[model samples]
Target: MRRLRIEGYVIVSADGRLANVDNLMPDELKFEGDKKFFSAALDQADLILHGRNSYEDQPSSPKRNRIILTRKVGTIAPDPSNPKATLWNPAGASFEAACDHAGIGSGTVAVIGGPGVFGMFMDRYDTFWLSLAPRVRLPDGEPCFPGVPARSPQDVLAAHGLKPGEVQMLDPEEDISVTPFRRAAS
Candidate 1:
């Protein structure tokens, strides 16, 4: 059996917001270093899973196999907008099945998301790359994990048995940092 590792990638503000009030990621909230890190990670993944909203916002990348998670069943089909993408409903198809549908047999699977998508795979994440801009705070923004009662992203990851690793400074001037939390060894 091929063991598939699911990894989550997210960029949040100091306040744990993933997006602004409009449900859109603002320019000020974006950092070049974080973008490069995430893009490189995705480039190396065998499969990428995203929520419908995030999938729609992403530019088409034919080289990467992607699955867009949706709630509407019976809509499992190739995405019309992106040839390398598929619309999948987890309720009808398992994650393994979705990977098979995308022709991914093994290796890392990147889960890039909206809050629900991130929350859905919380328990399965082998590692979560959480990048944050300490100086940035979105008072009225969407959280990294919606409806999660945890006060902070760290608390949420800790609740899932992930232990925080060393923090890497992505942008010193901007005070942006990336932290990797790996599942504790059994």
Candidate 2:
């Protein structure tokens, strides 16, 4: 069985503007603190899977193996302009199989969001790494994850049989939210 991980930052505001689809790095709120945590998490994963929108939002680089999921088939290479990232259209093997091929066996295979991608594999995702920024505020932007029936993370986790780990606060000054989850053993 392939391991799936869902991880992203979402702003819990009334308007849901803080978690914009346009912004690649929502945790970058004029502080290096959040960036540090994200960077650390990114390092744990050998491969990164993201939706087309999230992939396009990122600056092309060769630092890590990237998989962009889309509908088209026979597409496996990253953009010619940026050779670092790889594109994976639904082909002979499913996206999960492609991640296994990319050598994500035991290491973390992070599913960065575009909403649909997260929703598609929410049940299959083994771990959920979430960061809650406490102080900074965004009044206008798209949501972090969309299209799922409105429910608290706790509620969703209970439905999926996931449990939270011991709470670890990053910065008391920032009042940030740092949450992590893992699937409970069946």
Candidate 3:
């Protein structure tokens, strides 16, 4: 059996928020270093999984295969705007099946998120690259993992059996650091 390694990438504020109350990630909150890191990671991945909102917010990339997660069953089909992307309803199809539908054999499957999507793959992610800007705190913002309630991102990852690796400072000027959390080996 071909084992698919699921990876996640997220950038959060010091208070563990992913976005502001307006559901928008402000430009000042975004670090260039994090963008470079994530872009390079995606460049090497065989497939990418994103929530519907995230997918719609960005311009489509025809070079990379992508699956946009949605709740609408029977909506699995090629995206009309992007030939390289597919709309997938995970409730109607398994992840493996979705990979097959996207013609992905085996490789890193990067899941870029908006809360619920991150929570959905909490148990399956082999590694989660959690980048944080400690100086920035969005008091009334959307959390990195919604429905998780009052827990730090580290606590949430730990609860799901992932051990945090050494923190790498991506940008000292911006006070942005990335901690990779990997599932403990059985």
TM-scores, all candidates, are: 0.92, 0.73, 0.93
Model 2 — which ten-residue stretch has the worst lDDT?
A: 9-18
lDDT of the candidates, in the order given: 0.84, 0.58, 0.85
Displacement of residue 51 (Cα, Å) in model 3 is 0.6
Q: lDDT winner among the candidates?
A: 3
Per-residue lDDT of candidate 2, residues 42-135 (tens digit): 6666677777776423232357777777766474545454445556776545766666546555556667766666656667667676556645
* lDDT agreement of model 2 with the native: 0.58
Task: List pairs with backbone clashes in candidate 1.
Answer: none
TM-score of model 1 (CA atoms): 0.92
User: Where's the lowest-lDDT run of ten residues in candidate 1?
Assistant: 54-63
Q: Tens digit of lDDT per residue, candidate 1, span 42-116?
A: 888888899877842334356788999987657476777878887898778787787887787899999989899
Candidate 3 lDDT over residue span 43-161, tens digit each: 88899898977742333356889998877648477777778887898778787888888888799999998898999999999999999998988888889895443888999999999
Residue 96 in model 1: shift from native, Å? 1.1
Off by over 4 Å in 2: 1-18, 21-31, 55-61, 72-78, 90-93, 100-106, 135-140, 147-149
